[model samples]
Target chain A: MSELISGSEILMQSLLKEGVDTIFGYPGGAITPVFDALYDFQDRFNYILTRHEQGATHAAQGYARVSGKPGICLVTSGPGATNAITGIGDAMMDSTPLIVIAGQVQAELLGTDAFQEIDLVGITQPISKWAYQIRRPEDITWAVARAFYIASTGRPGPVVLDFAKNAQIGKAEFYYKKCEFTRGYIPYPEISTKQIESAAQLINDAKKPLALVGQGVILGNAENELKSFLEKADIPAASTLLGLSAMPTNFRLNKGFLGMHGNVGPNMKTNECDVLIAIGMRFDDRVTGNLKTYAKQAKIIHLDIDPSELNKNVKVDAKVLGDAKVSLKLLTDAIQNAKHGEWIDSFKEHEEKEFEKVIKKEVFPENGPIKMGEVINLISEASNNEAILVTDVGQNQIMAARYFKYSKTRSIVTSGGLGTMGFGIPAAIGAKVAAPDRKVCLFVGDGGFQMTMQELGTILQEQIGVKIIILNNNYLGMVRQWQELFFRKRYSSSVMINPNFGAIADAYKIKNQEVKDRKDLKKAIDEMFSDDKPYMLIVETEKEGMVYPMTPAGDTVTHILLGDE
Target chain B: MENENMTLYTVSVFSENRVGLLNQISIIFTRRRLNIETLSVSPSALKGIHKFTITTFSDADTIEKVVKQIDKRVDIIKAFYNTDEDLVYQEIALYKIATDQLIKLGSIEEMIRTYNIRILEMNETCVVLEKTGHYEETQALFSELSQKVNVLQFIRSGRVAINKSKIERLSDMLANLNSRKPEGYVEDDEYAGY
Candidate 1:
């Protein structure tokens, strides 16, 4: 017979059974019972108390993205649950696995508009992979195990569990068990061998076959398999922003990034390839500019885990549904070795021209304020291409994607789909927590940094060793760039009279430095990385600096502009 | 062509009977800016589970995404989208007419035979009639009755549908789930009350 235990104890036991080592959360009135229960389990799992529920959620996302495990978060009801909505939406869009447990008002007080009462399960339904409200004490263990299973399966996403106050305090007979199967929920779809064989036949027949890789490669841990497939077939590959680290930057077949502000060759040559093999990417509009003209001539092969993604965007000649590693291995075994040397060299020629016209001036500027690109380049060099780079949205994100060369998978974490602004610092904290031995670096813009700057308190409290570099452009750089190019530089509300970030770091008891000169860029980065503690470096850059090679909205990828027109 | 191309899709969702599952399904429609023409919820053949039938006007692409989103909900066992021609559907409607108007016109008997509506109840003040058919057929009867008799009230239940396929999808899914169940976990029949 099983012994009886409180719902709070059951919650703690379920987490321990799942092997959770850390959880990020905030305390509140309704959640006090669970917090008290956590006090006894402090030796079992380390809890990092964040200042805001949003920060805790983002921190959880960061940890999930780095470790490929379900990140756990807790918060109170009403305002606390509402605060975590953005982070939940971000995780859903980016396919990050997270388990968020929220404390609700007592069972009897529910729907009575009691204090700290809200319909968290209903509110989070559209955004979460699953959302449930636990009513009975016996359901706590079942709910927790189910939540983790749903969060970490298939296309991973966030799941919310709302615990009624009474349920937490109530007692029930407990037997901790892991949920292995969910009715009607198929986590992994069966891979069809016929589809794999057809995909191989198409790849073998193409003269100019190009591989478009996305975050699926990293999620599947299929980086080595993808590398082998690309080399065996002699196919050049380009990465979507989130797929940055799937292949090392130094790989010969790596054609660099592809998108609005990506490399010259990848964007321009997308239309030129005869066959386009998309692995684990949904072909969102940003990656495929103006779908009417995007790779219309290419015979497309889409490989993704989600069956719904097939034929949703660009129609493909063949569709392979399964994990990237499994699908890639099948394709590699069936494919014949062939050389596309001429097609690969054609991309290099375009890269040479872009390097002469744009890359040279941006990375090795001689006389001006420190350019954002140069700072990213210096940091990339100083970090030895090993640090996990977490970047915020807007211009800073694009520059980091452009300049930083990652040599490891799961090395770049950023807000790709939702493009949330204040995602850098909190997510960096989560990444550092997930990978304590590896160095974690953050690149955030002035506009985005201010959105969640309160997380500096969490950094101070936990003493998390994340090196943060804020690119102080004194304006919303991406919006300003759009205004300059598209709206004739009206610059409406983009400019900012920002505060002293260094001083803010000081107030939080974190070490800080400010560098405005180009000569001091390397020295500042070296100093920041040399320290064993948390440090924030503010690098002031030219306010008018813009990310170039942008394909204007609704335009073809071939019509990319190298600079402001 | 654009107006004609906009199709009406019927989405059927099977889920466990949870308190807020209906509100969650409605929210998905609201987010997509699709209006719900009709929504019906009832218990399924399987115990402890419910089924929701929702109708919306959208193209194939939008309906596909909506079905995918609905399937993402934890309680939802499965969601299927079908066109009007793919399903056998009907709605029950009730119409109340003033008895004096029918008596004065002397066409109540003839109208009942022509429209295939049954007289549910009759009194001096009013006569209640019931009809079972597609929405358009019911609306036609209402229009015909209005000209002949003074119509007092009209109401229609939402659509209930069954796919033309021989086997029920829910039974197949449940069987699959049963086969994959781990040890010590009970089936839906043994699920404790919420």
Candidate 2:
């Protein structure tokens, strides 16, 4: 028989068995026992005590996105568990694997309105992939194993393990059996050969074909497979926001980004393609402007691991269900090698038109207040296109996503699905922790920067090397942009009286700088990337700058506005 | 609610007998604002597995998504939706009437005879009647009795459904689930049959 161990030890052991060495969390009433256990095993784990529970969950999400491992976090019950809800929802939408262990009132006191008592499971059920409560010591091993298994499987998402006070202190014989199977759970669905063949046939028969890729390619570790399929079929590929880093920016068949604020070429060409192959991407409303007018001319083919995502948005002519790597390889093998040089060249005219109107001006502006794009472009060059670009929501996210180039896979980490603000500081810290050797740069707006600026303390304490570039526009830029076009520029609650970010960084004992001129942008970025210690560079950006080449909400993808007009 | 796309659909979900599973399933319907017309839970033919049969009104798209979401649960084995025409179904209704008052309504026994209702118990004060049929048939019997005599209490069971594809498909699926044992896996002894 295995040696008797406390439930807290068993929990620690189970996490270790799953190859987890780091945990981001905060302590409170119900989870004190587990924290006490950590006192002894401190050398074995890098437990990060984040300033807030929400920051911990977002940090774990960023870790998960970068490492392809299920990020683990712990917090005490009641408000602690509730605080993690937004991050859990973000992880759910992003398909980022996270295992959140929240403390609970004792098994006996549960539902009695006891101190720190909350229905963590009930609250997390919708947002989490699975929420299981461990009420006894014996359940710890299996529950931990199950939580990791479910959180990291097919479409990765957050799993909450509600550890009760009794469970934390209860003693039981430790068994290290890994949960590889559950009776009713099917993590991976078999790839249907018939679906593959029909999809290949559609690809082969198409006159002009385009494929839009999403984060599933990176999640499936199918970047090479996608490249092969795109090359073999000679298809021009566009990327969803989450799919930014799946292919290198300089790849031959790479067309551009897709969505509301995406490039002009892909948005316009979406209507021109005869066959639209949606690979590893759900047709989010952002990508499909007006469903009625979006891709009506094309025969839609969707490929995803989740069956529900097949026809969830737009009806598809074909459904390829399986791991993307497997399906893409099958497709690459099934379809005859061919090239659509003339068809591929059709997007170039639209690209040059956008370049002259938007890209050239945004990134290469000669003067005026500092533009957001120039900062990102300078960072990309300064870091040699090797930095993992993380961003807070709004203009900075799209600006960095557009201007920053990626040379590494799994390099773009952001809250894509939920679009949560205050996600940047902690997420970038977690990213740096996950990839210590890789440079990590964050592009955040002034409004979002202060939302979770408390995590600057986490960086200083952990000494995490995350280069934070705050694009201070003195307004909630994305909302203001929308207000400018859609809301008649009323600017309700969009403007902000900013904080002294440099002083905040100084208080946190981290290196800091601020630049207002365009010429100083390159030098500031270079300085931020020079060393392996955390640095924050605040750049005062264009107060009223707008992200152009936008397909107005519910407007057809083909019809886009290049300028504010 | 009056949209032409709306139609009655029976969503049958098979899952392990698990705590909070019902609430999770209910949330799926509630979130969509689709009211559950009827819901029944019972042990399935397979040991350790329970089946929940729910009937609701939804458009084709919403129902399809709802069933898929139900099937996505970790403890859930499978979920399917069928129109009334696709399933052989029935609901059983029970009626309790005051015996003395019931007899005063002329031709009540004759009406019961025509409907093939079985009298479960009778006393000086009351009588209980049971009828099994489609929803409308059972409702018709209840309405007839309520109109003529006082129904002390009336109750109706949720619809029980079986796919017309035959029992072989069900057995085949059960067998298939049993065969799909992942590595280092064993069914708990509580689920003895599997």
DockQ of each: 0.56, 0.53
CAPRI-wise, candidate 2 is medium
Q: State residue A417's C-alpha deviation in candidate 1, in Å.
A: 0.9
- lDDT comparing candidate 1 with the true structure: 0.89
After superposition, candidate 2 runs with Cα above 4 Å error: B168-171, B183-194
Candidate 2 global TM-score? 0.97
Lowest lDDT sum, 10 consecutive residues, model 2 chain A, at: A175-184
For residue A103, model 1's alpha carbon misses the true position, in angstroms, by 1.0
> On residues A1-565, what C-alpha lDDT tens digit does candidate 1 reach at each position?
6788899998998899998999999999888899999999999888999989999999999999999999999999989899999999999999899999999999999889999898888788878888888988988887888889889978889999999999999999877677777776777667899999999999999999999999989888899999999999999999999999999999999999988888889888789999999998989888888999999889999999887788888989999998898999989999999999999999988899778777777788899877888888889989899889999999999999989988888999999999999999999999999999888989999999999999999999999999999999999999999998889999999999999998999999999999988888888888998876899999999889978778877788888788734
Q: What TM-score applies to chain A of candidate 2?
A: 0.99
Instruction: Give per-residue lDDT, candidate 1, residue B61.
Output: 84
Model 2 per-residue lDDT tens digits across residues A1-565: 7688899988888888899989999999999999999888899999999999999999998899999999889999999999999899999999999999999999999889998888988888888888888888987887887888889988888999999899999999887766667766777788888999899999999889999999999999999999999999899999999999899999998887999989888888899899999988889988999999989989888999888788888999999988898889998999988889999888889989999999888989887888888888888988889999999998999899888898889999998889999999889988988999999999999988888999988988899989999999999999999999889999999999987889999999999899988877778877887799989899999999999878888889877888845
The RMSD of every model to the true structure, in order and in angstroms, is 2.0, 1.9
| Candidate 1, superposed: residue stretches over 4 Å from native | B165-169, B177-194
Interface RMSD of 2: 2.2
TM-score of each: 0.96, 0.97
